[model samples]
Target: MERKIKIFMIDDDPDDREFFQIALDMTGIRYTLKTAESAVEALNIFPEFLELPDYIFLDLNMPLISGIQFLQIFRESADLNKVPIIIFSTSSYHKDIEDTKALGASHFLSKTSDIDRLSEVVVSILKGNDLPFILT
Candidate 1:
């Protein structure tokens, strides 16, 4: 049996987290989704996990430590560096995309209101497509 994908999502908004869960559920792919409302909470729980996440989705805006800050710290850890990090944010700013890409983010995707589109993007990423952004 194939192993299920492990996904970690860090976003302050509960609604956005719920949306992501819904999107993942729609994909029909085998995955375990874990969420943290803030970077601090994620960091606190990260080291406790027996198996690290296969992929991490980060939101740009948050109270205290932002996603970019979290990414820097996350990438600095030797054990966490190899995991693919995707910047999943509501911001459509070019600078945000450029910054995260320079910091080693695997992909940057704008948060979509459409759940189906989000599901498609998740499927593409899981399939190992090299595209930086998933065009609707």
Candidate 2:
């Protein structure tokens, strides 16, 4: 039997979260999605969710701690390093993408216009499919 894909989304916006859910739903991919509105919330849940996620979609711009900061913290935690992290952000800055890749991000995707693109990207990542970015 195929293992179900587990996903964790660290994004502050409710609309974006909803968009992701809809995107995933349209894909028909079996997954368990957990959402955290802030880095603190994500960190708080990390202990219990250790190595549970197959993929993590994080937003770059957030309150308090940014995605890069969160990635730094997550990387320092040995248990969290095993899960693949993808920066799903609106900013397409080369510096940000390169920085996250250097920090060990699996991929960096700029936020797309709709759920279809998001779903496509997520499906590709889950299938170990590679796509082009600033660093890929």
Candidate 3:
């Protein structure tokens, strides 16, 4: 049996986190999801997890320690350096996209409200299917 894919999402908004969970459920893929409401919270808790997630979705905007800051920290951690991290954000700013890529983000995707599209993208990512991204 194939092991379920593990995904971690760090976002501040409760509504956004709910929407993302709902979208993941709609994808019909076997996945285990762990969420952190803030980047600081994630940093504190991630080290406790025995198995690192296969992928990490980070919100660009957050209260303390923004996604970029978290990315920098994550990069420094030997255990997390190789995990694929996707910058999931509402901002489509060119600078944000470029910065995320330069900082070692595997992909940059604008947060979508459409559940179907979100599900599609999640499924594609799990299956190692390529989805077009601005920076990579």
- Better lDDT candidate (1, 2): 1
lDDT score of residue 10 within candidate 2: 97
Using all chains and alpha carbons, the TM-scores for the candidates as numbered come to 0.95, 0.91, 0.94
User: What overall lDDT goes with each candidate model?
Assistant: 0.89, 0.85, 0.87
The residue-by-residue lDDT of candidate 2 on 67-110, one tens digit each, is 99999999997777888998988888878988999998988877
Instruction: In angstroms, give how far residue 125 of model 2 lies from its true place.
Output: 0.8
Consecutive 10-residue window with the lowest summed lDDT within model 1: 127-136
Candidate 2 collision pairs: none
Candidate scoring better on TM-score of 2 and 3: 3
Q: Write the per-residue lDDT of candidate 3 for residues 1-136, one digit (tens) a residue.
A: 7788999999999998999899899988888989999999999898689999999999999987999999998998777898999898998888888888888988887788788888888778778876666522
lDDT of 1 by residue, 27-52 (tens): 88899989999999988989788999
Candidate 1: give the clashing pairs: none
Clashes of each: 0, 0, 0
After superposition, candidate 1 runs with Cα above 4 Å error: 133-136
Estimate the overall C-alpha local distance difference test score of candidate 1: 0.89
Q: How accurate is candidate 3 locally (lDDT)?
A: 0.87
- Candidate 3 weakest ten by summed lDDT: 127-136
